[model samples]
Each structure stands twice: as C-alpha cells, then as structure tokens.
Target: MPSADPSTQPLKSAEELAQSRRRFPGESPQYRAARNALLKEEIELRRHIERVAAQRRALPPGGEIPEDYRFESESGPATLSQMFGEHDTLVTYNWMFGPKRQRSCPMCTSFLSALDGEMADILQRVAFAVIARSPVERLTAFKRERGWRHLRLYSSGGNTFNRDYADEDPDSGDNAGFNVFVRSNGIVRHFWGDEMGPETADPGQDPRGAPDAMPLWTVLDMTPGGRGTDWYPKLEYGAQSKTGT
Candidate 1:
C-alpha cells in the first residue's frame, strides 16, 4: 500500500474508534451493542466540548471596563479589581436575589448550591464570587440559610455594576448571570459571559449555556429518564421525620 500523508488521511469515525470489549455480567449482547454505540457518541461529545473550550480561550481580549465598580462584601465596600485578589482571572455569578424580591430565583439558587461545594477547589485556580443585588445583610442571611460557607458572597447594591454588566434587568431587577473578568497589565477587561436566555432556548427546552455548568442536569441526563420538564430544584425540600417517632 502506498504511504498516506498524515494530514490528508481521513479521521476515523467515532464508531470506528469505539473498541470497548469489556462487558458487565448479566448484560445482554443487545444491551452491550447499544452501549457501545452510545459510547461512541459520548466520545464525540467530549471532543466537541474541548473544541468549543479552545475557541473560547483563543478569543481576543474583550471590552475593557472603564470604571472600577464598587461592591459590598462581608468585610466592607470593595472594587471590582479588589475582588480578583491574587488571581488575574475572576469569575462572578450574579445571582437573582434583588432586594425587592422576597426570595431568590430557584434556578439561580440551584446553580449556586452546586457551586458552593466546589468553591474551594475552584478558588485554587481563580478568584470566584457570588454577587446579588440585595443588601449585604440580606444576602448573608440567605447564604447562612443555604449553608454556603466557602463562596465569597457580595452585594452589588448602591452601584451600577449589575446594570453595567447586564446582570440586572433595568426595569424588573430580576437577573441571573455568570461573568468572567481578567486583569492583564493593570487593565481589567471582560473575558466571557453566559448570554443565553429564554429567547435563545431551543424548542421544548429551557435556555441553558453550552457545556451545562450544573452537575444536577448532567447527572439526570445519564439516567434512562432524563431531566424531566416538570421537575426543578427547590430552596427547601420536605423534611423526613425520624422513623417510628
């Protein structure tokens, strides 16, 4: 056979690359075959995720923030730059808990709940924070209720940070946004953000960002019964009483 140029050679199909032979006991041959087919699709999904991530990283520097917006932290007032701490990159989640609202958005709360657990691990690489439009006291109270200890919570009240960042609805004040900022050579600039909204949602699906950020949905997707349309996370679930009490 004539030697083929590596660059010109056609890439192997995902199905062709799936070579798993191990089988679980009691699994039918039909089941194994179906699983192998699904595995091939999963491999392609992983590759697509990597490709999109690379494109994100290669993006040109985003718009420079003109002002050092002020925010209320547990310690006191802090600037956007101050939020970065020792890291050049900062990830801030704009939670939908405006002062006027009695409760925060359940969806935002759900996302934050998962993030709370990973705060320590995520902070090791970059600065992370959860910002809300409510007053610091109110935000802290809810934080306590949620049992989130690691997430650095902040209040964007008394500032235009939320409005400037598109994290707050100008008229309604309800918001849920995830934004990233980067400081390079003493200049701060917007890095990325989750711009997807209800308008962008596909037919019969809720609007969600690519590479879903929450594990709840991801785990549910793996099961035979996928994330149900009617089910959603709640702030409080019904308590289970002690047996025989």
Candidate 2:
C-alpha cells in the first residue's frame, strides 16, 4: 500500500475504483452486458431501500417529543430537538475520538476522517453531529490534528447524554455507537441504533441509524477492496482492549 498524501485526494471509494477498472477499454459485448446488469441491480436495490425508508416515515405517529432533555454546550444549554438545528431530524455519531490519553477509535476514526471534506449538502438536508462524552475542546483539538474540517461536533461530556443514549454503560463497560433522534408530537424519541444485531469484531458495535458517516464509505467504495478483510480500525492509545491485552 502507498502512503496517502494528506493534502491530495481523489475522493473515490474502493468499489468505485474497482468498477472503473472493471470497465473495458474496447467495446466488448460481454463486458458491456455485465456492466449494465450490475448497474440495473444496484439501481433496483437502492430504490427498494428508499421505498422502505418511505414506509418507515409513513408509519403512524408514536409518542411526543420530550422537551426536557437539556444538554449543556459551550454556548449554553439545548434541547434534544434543538440539536437538529431547524430541521425535523438529527443524527449523532458516538465517537471515541477523544484526548491523546484515549486517542481515537480506529474504526470510528477511519469513518470520521472520511467525513472531514464534504458535509455541506448533508447538513442542508438533515442536521448531523458527532457527540462524545469528552469535552468539546478535546474533540476540536483531535479533529484539527486529524485535519477533518467538514464534520460538526458537540460536547456531551458534562451531561448524562452518554448514559441516556446507551453509548456508555458504566456497569457493562461499553464504549460507543451511532444513534438517530426524531421529533414527533413535540417529543424526541430515539428511533434507531446498533440494536439490529450484527456480529462484529468489537465487543460492542452498532450500525448507526444516522447518515453522517456514510459519505466516506461512498468515497472509499471507489477503491479496489471496497472495504474488505484487510481493513480494520483500532484505538490509538493501544490496539488491545482496556481490560485485556
């Protein structure tokens, strides 16, 4: 593998790169047909996903948005609903990217560093933020060190937000995750998290119901492996777990 230049980027995902290579230089009937078939399949899958999401949105209203989930920020306090900005929804990524003592989560960092460059469009549609129990100052410092400028971050350090979100459980020794918050009937209810049940490397890993960290995967798909076996994220402080080597 070659060293990537921090300043220069092609912004292509592993899959995209693979696709580009798979294309034929000369017009071969078989190649063209294969490509078209793949394209059609992908389009169908995407449409199916969209339709499912539409159904989820169309589900009958459930509960009311809680007005009292107060969070203290650098500027001041904000309600859970206010975290979405002026939009109707918000996505928060529970990042382990904290101080040097803690370093960063390799998996989370890989996903996050990918987020540094293009977020304007996503923000325009839905509010997004990376929330960590660590201080905002720590979060900002780490982001600067990593050169990730496009992501929006907030401090949940001073509050019970982490506990409430299920990202951290003092009893379980849990770490992190991604969650989605939706406001309905003036109450904020958490609609999604990693509870879908997928076996993974980390003792605890939840598929984020949010969309903030996806752009990087989209870009990385342009690469050859397209996020394969060789790729794995780690914690910067040390590769081993806190409780074990």
Candidate 3:
C-alpha cells in the first residue's frame, strides 16, 4: 500500500476550519469576523511552532562536554553519564536554589511545580532531572515540602556544572536554565540550552523565548490582560518568605 504524500496534498483553509468548529449564540458579525481573523493567525502560529521544532530537531551535534560533571543525589554521588539512566537523552533544569539564596527562585519554582506534574510522562521517554547548587539535602527537603515526588533532584554544589551550563556568573549569581544533553557512543555532548536573555530581549518586553516554557505565563498570556508587567510568581502567594533557607 502506498501512503499519500503530505507535502503534495492540498491544504485546508484555516478560515473555513476555524469558523466551522463552533459559533456562540448572540455573537455579533463584527465579533465573529475578528474572532475568525484571530483564529487564522492561531492556525499559522501552530504551524510556525511545528516548523521551529523541526528545525531544532535537525540541528547538528553540539560540542562535547569538557568533563563529566559530578553531582550529589539523594542516593549519593552521580556523574553526568550516570544521570541518563537507561536513556541516551537527558533534559535538565538548573534551579536557582543556591547556597546564597534565601529560597528558590519563585519563577523557577513555578515552572518546576508545573513540570513536576508531567515528570512521570517525561521520564517515560527521556531522562529528566532538576539540578541545583544547593546541597542535596537542602534540595530534597524543599522537594518534600513541595510534595514533588516525581522530580529527580540532584545537588551540583560540589561541581562546576552550574557555572558551565546554568549561567552562574561569579558576581551576578545564578539564573534558572534549561539544558539538554545526549549520550552517544559512550560520550556525552551538549545538545542545547535556552539562550534568550536581557541582551536578546525586545523593547518593552520581558526577556523570554518563543513558545514560552512556563504554563503559568502561557495561561496568563491567553487572558484579556495578557500577562501584565507588574506581576510574577511567588513562593507563597500572600506570605513573606524568611531571609534564608
């Protein structure tokens, strides 16, 4: 049996598809027209996201890591290769819970809170871990407090893993980072890391990358206010945190 060529197939009209789905009662013609127009853009946005993902998948092999970074896990010491478990690919989030910080970055915590829910599903495919400069005990204690059972927390306090990959500046301190690595033929290599920062930021906009990673921001962006400038995630919504962890 021969399969149809997707590229050669005729495409459906976004406008028609958007309008055909559903219509609300008492919607005015002006509202419907505007809604339909926005829907078409949304369709294009989805297509663009696919294209970007495809491009990322097609990237050539990145530079090999200089050394096998060490980490302290709840179970004890682990190497970068050991972190991959049975999978060749590993996705790590560098948490901003350093020895100097009073508490973990609220923004990082929010992202992890959402990611924790999907950790099981994520691990079913690629290995996922949360790395922090804080001691393993400190990291695990916070994990227990947050009730995050699925996340694999490891301490990078004994190594330069954070300095190399997590944007750990000697003076400015640490910033949350997301990085991917791959192990091939018994060698580990850097795959990619989030590079968007203040230098790349657009005017009047916060420094963030496309297809925003945080669900909190994504959901807010869909609202009428569209992720207001003044607000941000907090460790405790209404309460003040102590000076140190």
The model with the greater lDDT, 1 or 2, is 1
Which ranges in model 3 have alpha carbons more than 4 Å from their true place?
Answer: 5-10, 13-16, 238-245
Query: Model 2, range 1-245, lDDT digits (tens) per residue?
Result: 98889536654443453343455568787877677667766665665677667776676654453444665454566666778778877877777644333566676777777655557777888788777666777777877887886787777655666776754654444356766677666667766655432444344443443232466566656687665555355434464457321
Top TM-score: which candidate number?
A: 3
What is the C-alpha local distance difference test score of each model? 0.86, 0.63, 0.87
Q: What's the number of clashes in each of the models?
A: 0, 23, 0
Model 3 score (lDDT): 0.87
TM-score of each: 0.90, 0.65, 0.92
Cα deviation of 116 in candidate 2 (Å)? 3.9
- Per lDDT, what order, best first? 3, 1, 2
Hey, what RMSD does candidate 2 come out at?
11.0
TM-score of model 3 (CA atoms): 0.92
Instruction: Please report how far candidate 2 places residue 191 from its true position, in Å.
Output: 4.3
Q: Residue 213 error for model 2, in Å? A: 5.0
Q: Give a tens-digit lDDT track for model 1, residues 1-245.
A: 98889747777889888768788989998998998998899989987998799899998999999799898899899999999999999998888888788887878888888998899999999999888888999988988887988989888887887887865665686767789999999999999988998889999998888899989999998998999977677776667322311
| Candidate 1: regions farther than 4 A off | 1-13, 240-245
Which wins on lDDT, candidate 2 or candidate 3? 3
Residue-wise C-alpha lDDT for candidate 3, range 1-245, written one tens digit per residue:
89999967887877767774567999988888889899998998987898898898888999999999889998999999999999999999989888888888888888999999999899999999899888899999999988897999999888888889977873577777789999999999999898998889999998887889989889888999998887667787534544322
